[model samples]
Target: MLNMKSRYAMRALLYLAGRYGDGPVQIGEIADSQRIPRKFLTVILSELSREGIIGTKRGRAGGYWLEREPSAISYGDIVRITRGSLALVPCAARLAYEPCDNCVPESECHLRLVMLAVRDATADVLDRLTLADPLPGQVELQPERQAAPAQ
Candidate 1:
């Protein structure tokens, strides 16, 4: 399961994406708009800024904005930045890996292979889903109209 930090990061990024190209936005505004607690969001934003995922400004109008174009930023990027890895199991992780306690030899572990597949699929989906993509429920996917059945 995704951690609170990752969830908050996604919410903050979505809020920033909505205001992209509008210049820096205040932390108070993002917290309020996203319904995230201002105090917790402050820490998250600071970490994101440090990660180069976001840029910050100081003063009355100071706040935060994406350091890169929204289209270039992916959910995977934020999740990896906040949570460190996308893999459900350490042995299946790309960046961070540790042999599972039950597995004697990782090279021959069948479960590791399955976990890796799951990890890969998750990475693919998140990497392709950009911050610029419309927020959930903001757009609906509709099926094409079906043709009349032949007599």
Candidate 2:
């Protein structure tokens, strides 16, 4: 599950995506519309801005907007940036792998194998989505959808 900050970030990013090319949006508007706490939103937006996922301006007309096109930003990108990894265990992480404490070696661990599989499947689903993708219930996938290759 995603942390509150990351969840807030996604909502804010989605808001920005919808308002793309409409110019910067005020932070308060995003917080109010998304029901994220105003102070917390400021921190989240600032982090996103620092990470270059969103751009900010300051002035009477200043606000925040996505640095890239909405379709260019995927759910995977957001997850990785905010949450670090899709893995339930640290060892199963692709980008931030580390051995789990008190665990058996990788080659001998059944749990690790299952977790790696779960992580890949999770990445497949999340990576397949972008802010521009139709909402979950809005689009239907054919049965022909492919499983990700083995890890």
Candidate 3:
């Protein structure tokens, strides 16, 4: 399950991406448009700023903007930054891997094996997709048609 912070961050980033070259977007506008809390968004944006994912300005006209082009940032990078690991479990994590405590040895652990596969598959999809990609809900899909019955 995705955490609220990650969800909010993605929303904020997407909103920023839409306004990429238009200049900084005010926090209140983003919050009201995306339905995220102002305080929470402030914290998230600050963390992203420190991570170099975003840039901020200060003044009467100051606000936030992306540091890099949206296409340069991948969903995987965002997930890793916010969630620490794409792996469903710690034992399956690549950068943050840890042996399961008081459990079967790694080589023989089926759970770990399954999780490894899951992590890789998840990474494959997320890494290939950038923030510039159209979000799932944003795209329209054709509805399936019914098949005729055989005589």
Candidate-wise lDDT, in order: 0.90, 0.89, 0.89
User: How large is the C-alpha RMSD of every model relative to the true structure?
Assistant: 7.2, 10.6, 8.5
lDDT of 2 by residue, 28-106 (tens): 8999999999999998888888888999999899999999999888888888888888898899999899999998888
Best candidate according to lDDT: 1
Badly placed stretches (over 4 Å) of model 3 are: 136-151
Cα lDDT of model 1 by residue, 60-112, tens digit: 88889998999999999998998999998899889888878866698778888
Error of 1 at 71 (Å): 0.2
lDDT of model number 2? 0.89
- Minimum summed lDDT over a 10-residue window in model 2 is located at 136-145
How well does each candidate superpose onto the true structure, as a TM-score?
Answer: 0.85, 0.86, 0.86
